[model samples]
Target: MSAKVINITMNGLPMEVYEGMNVLEAARIMGIDIPTLCYDEGLSSYGACRLCIVEIGPQDRTKVVSSCTYRCEEGLEIRTHSKRVMDTRKMILELLVCSTPGSKTIQDLAAAHGVITARFKPEHEDCMLCGLCVRMCKEQMMATAIDFAGRGPDRRITTPFDEASALCRHCGGCMFICPACSSRCMGPDADTTLCSSCLNLSPSCVEVYDHQQCWMPPGCGTCIRPEGDYLPATGRISEVKTEA
Candidate 1:
């Protein structure tokens, strides 16, 4: 079978790729690196981070756009890291880091771009609002247990009515896939919780916990408790009967 071809240019370098492939994937295949925090190979393009912005066009060149969401088209020209693009990306990373200072993903991205510190004060405690948790829950787990609750800055991840998620299988997939949760503790106690840092720094803890079953308590019942009986016994009668 003949493969479909799509001609494009990267930094003035002419290239040909498949018709349906995304610009970011095509560029990666061609050894072009576009820094991205929200774009994951396993998940769909979120385009929330806006770090992988690239200039694309031919005659009338368009403004810098996210390469992760943009598809490669015939005769398309892309500039992965122009001066303007780099500056914009840096600002974006700075803003994201300012919002979520504790996020390792944001810190790593900032460091990669030579950003020593965030310009603005930290606003949020956790969660960058990248929508990764919501997307993963819906798409991968096929459980619409939680989602974005509000709009703009007030937006947060939550189940319906901010209660325990019934649709959730407790698979912990959302927590596992979350970059924010990656660095937190997992046990009943916050201090004893297992985080990504704990896992990496103390690999032996995983084995010890597994052998001791520290994470899972013993004598745990999977079944639900039966409701209490309200009806009285057939042989039992009231000693002092009052007027009904």
Candidate 2:
């Protein structure tokens, strides 16, 4: 039987999506992109990365929810790139950068979300606890070779007793799926906690509205605000034209 359809609003536009479809799925169907790291199509939904968060419900009672794990409901209102949602995502990216300073995936995502710096001390650690490796090994590879152990800051993915697991076929699926496996081309030294080398342009839509008006990247170079001046009310992102 076909799934039931539900009505929902996203980014001020009404969408009819499957009732049990997650926010990410609904967004994907509408050609809307919501950035995510730990939500691979081959794997199950694991909201560990916190990158696909979106603001839901009315302004007075809005709540930030992970799109990968949150299903759409009737009459639900979701804003994928609101000021509050972007702020929360940027904060999460900063923390991820601190945890794994060498991950190219994390670094690129940070730059995309306008995360220029990380406040916490850089751990330069190998893992950000996304659990992709663990899940890949158990579910896809059919070998529970490694599992997360410990708690708090000490938590980690390791074989039982930290010994080499005999069941491991070393098919390299875990390493292949690991987002942190791709290290920054430059070294992750203390001096370079964040590799902003690839950073092109930060979004300026946040300065104008609570949510982004122009969703495109390097969008509307027109809104560059002076240090002591606000943009003229007449100068809007839509007024500026760019080459396609």
In terms of lDDT, which candidate is strongest? 2
Residue pairs of candidate 1 with colliding backbone atoms? 185-193, 186-193, 186-194, 187-193
State how far residue 29 of model 2 sits from its true place (Å): 1.3
Candidate 2 versus the native: TM-score? 0.75
TM-score of each: 0.72, 0.75
Worst 10 residues of 1 by lDDT: 216-225
Q: Residue 53 in candidate 1 has what lDDT?
A: 93
Q: Give all candidates' CA lDDT scores.
A: 0.64, 0.71
Candidate 1 local lDDT, 1-244, one digit each (tens): 8769978899999998988788899889889898877677878998988988998776365688899899888888898888888998889988876666545556667778877666776564467777786788888889988888888768877778876667877655665566654443222333222122221222121121121111222211111112322212221212212226
Clashes of each: 4, 0
Candidate 1: residue 157 Cα off by (Å): 1.3
